[model samples]
Target: MVDFFYSNQLRYRISRHLLYWLSFNLFLAFIWGSTGESYQIHLTVQALLWPARIFVVYGTLYVLIPKFFLKRNLFVFGISYIIWLLLVTIFVQRTVWQYSRSFFFPDWKNYDMFNVTEIMGNVFDLNLAAVFPLVFVFVKFYNAEQKKYLTLEREQYKSELNQLRNQIHPHFLFNTLNNLYSLILKKSDEAEDALIRLSGLMRYMLYEANVPKVPLSKEIEYLRNYIDLEKLRLNASNTIHFTSSMNKDQEIAPFILMPFVENAFKHGISNDKVSTIEISIIANKDLLTMTVYNTKKINANQDNGEKTGVGLVNVQKRLELLYKDNYEMIRNETESHYKMELTLNLI
Candidate 1:
């Protein structure tokens, strides 16, 4: 209903204005006729007076308000308004009312042209008629300002999201390249296969993942490829467990889950000690849940804001921006392991 009134369509504007004027005229007729006067005569008089009332209302709304009042030219606006009110009251409203009364009651004495009381009454009536329509003018100004603010906010969000995503791209690539270089230095045959998988990952990042959302199946495939790349560099002491279940098709913000899995692999593995990394994903209807757990060397400073790299922090910010109240995340640490669990609503 609010949208209907504020709509910019010509037909809607015409209908809304017509309805307001009709209601205003009927109200005036009712008020005047209640004092034992003929209702039809009062209605006709109000109808004849519409031309002057419309001129006063529209001139104030479109010209006086915009040109002087909104510009803060208070002295000019006051002078112009008073002049407009007197002219309309004397030349237009008084002439219309006296002629209308004369037509209705030929026996009644006509009001004098310069009578002070009659001029003041016409001025009051004109101001009263303009009051309700003036409310609409302010309403339109407020709506325009609100729309402009929201547009700026949306643009800022897009720019920040893009910056965060760009930061992740180079960070992930640097880590993967380091792994690939290590394999090549060892004369490992796995280097060739890792390069191929890396090419596919880069393709997805550059193209498919650039959008706001991607199919859950495609994201899962990307994760699998990433895990395979990491597996090439893993030793016998490292153990990884990955599991997933999905009952229906879904779309999710791209790369939202990758940082957790990447963090697990980067910090979990140990050369001399047994290392274990576990990952799980489950999707049902509009909900998705993920868990990543990895064993890491215990340190006293881990809980004291020690640097844990950029991936986790970047992902946390992205989650807040994209999902806000629709997602929940929990982190836990113990003597030997770090775990993160995320629950997201796809809808």
Candidate 2:
């Protein structure tokens, strides 16, 4: 009952009433056909009879089939027809019996006067005439609504995923350029090496990163190149210590782990502080875990109010949508350090 109301079964109710009224009017016409005299009197009788007929027929349908019975289509149709048959039997018998009792109950000879089959045929004719058209209309409308809704939802999801993917490209390019600028300032011979690495990174971003997924080994190689470039920039100051370990034989979504590493190197290391950044990745047949930790300056600049960097915040949103309950991300910060650990259950 609650589901019916919440589903707003107004159309169903209207169909039921329409079917019942049509059936009742046909039955009333059939009854009146057997009597020709006093047409006005018979029409008045039909007007009164229709209300009771509708109440009994549609009321039984509403209660038994929708509210009480199993609600299967075959069961509802079969039982409703059986109920209508019984009601018609009683109506025909009472009408004939009343007429006989009035005149010659004791002397009646021919008892098989009325045709029962014709009456039952008329009842079925009325029911099918109303049911078929309404069933067609309802099914057509329902299917169209379902298709439109699914199409809209699919387009919305595609748009959102595209926006998120666009964000990754610019963020990555910005960080790589920053690292290149740092190398040029010190006139290091490794600046040539940095350019070579940057070209490889650009090739990967243009070709491989556009794919939905890439081998874990390829992504790890990308990260290693990025780390080496950063290393060349910090060689003069010697303030950044970076360590990395990974699985060389597994696969993962491309670029999934880069933002955390980028954030650590961006916020954790400085020109004046001796800082350490450690990254580790372990992958098995069913799971992958990546952890990154970086040391913070004792008197780090505190004016910026951003907790996780913008790149990491974007990564978090993507993780929530893509992995849902299949992943866990933990981020913690204290007066001395910042840490992030992400675990993904891969299919």
Candidate 3:
């Protein structure tokens, strides 16, 4: 639909320009012919003047404007434009008019070819023909500048997004390796299984998650694997529940939902007390909603300086860069619990 609309607009602009030039030529012929005995002769004379007019207009548009006017060399631009105008007026327009008039209307009075007043008048009239196309020059320049600006902005956005995504890899691997270290120290029977799960997670991070977006199902699988790993480090007192419901496969920004779950497991679990972390995801055709809620351990040392984990901060930044106004996040924290709710418009 958008392409169709722009295509129609381009056609309209082309037709309008063609119509304008046709009308302008006819108008010039009618005005000039009114003073002549034969309108047909005057029309032919006007037709002969078209090449000079085209030269003046297009030279100003494609040459002078780009070379000097747009370069902020106004003094040079002014001087060059004046010289160009005079050269075309003298060598093309005036010569064409003189010879064509003498050929068609042999009895008509002829003026001195180099009369300053006569040449100036001719210059003024020729300039009038060049007026309308100047609007096109300025419009083209404005569009070019706007396109350049948008391209730069998009490149900067991608650079920042990639930097944020890279930050997640180290933060995630560091936490997982710490868990593995504890299991190895205890000589736990689950160490080998944990190593296998870590390998799978690393594979996903290294290979699959490098793209701008991934299938929602793949992201969910990653989250489940991370949750299973965290579960291995927990005792009977720590409870974690994760639920997801998706009607269809959809693509989403990679690892966008991982930080909240990581934050919950990091800050909400304790061996000495009962703690709970609840994570839920619901995705439909138009929207994806995720909620993560965790109860803070009572005796755990709380570092109030950084309420949100490092991974969470990077995720929030990524959300702003990727989704802009299409996503909403709500964060609520109290003495007992912390909750994060995110809603994304998938369409």
Q: Give me the candidate number with maximum TM-score.
A: 1
Ordering by TM-score: 1, 3, 2
Q: After superposition, how far is residue 7 of candidate 1 from its true place, in Å?
A: 6.8
Compared with the true structure, what per-residue lDDT tens digits does model 2 show for residues 249-329?
665666778888888777777668667777887776668888888877555556234743666777777777667798998
Least well predicted 10-residue stretch by lDDT in candidate 3: 1-10
- Name every residue pair that clashes in candidate 1: none
Candidate 3 residue 43 Cα shift, in angstroms, is 6.5
Pairing residues by index, what is the TM-score of model 2?
0.59
lDDT scores for all predictions? 0.84, 0.67, 0.83
Residue 179 C-alpha lDDT in model 3: 93
lDDT value, residue 101 of candidate 2 = 40
**Which candidate number has the best lDDT?**
1
Give the alpha carbon lDDT tens digit for every residue of 5-81 in model 1.
Answer: 88878888888889988888778867886788877776676677678798888899779999997786879987998
- TM agreement with the true structure for every prediction: 0.75, 0.59, 0.72
Instruction: Select the stronger candidate by TM-score from 1 and 2.
Output: 1
Give the per-residue lDDT of model 3 (tens digit) for 80-168: 98998899878853577577657766765666668888778767767877777776556666777898999999999999888888888
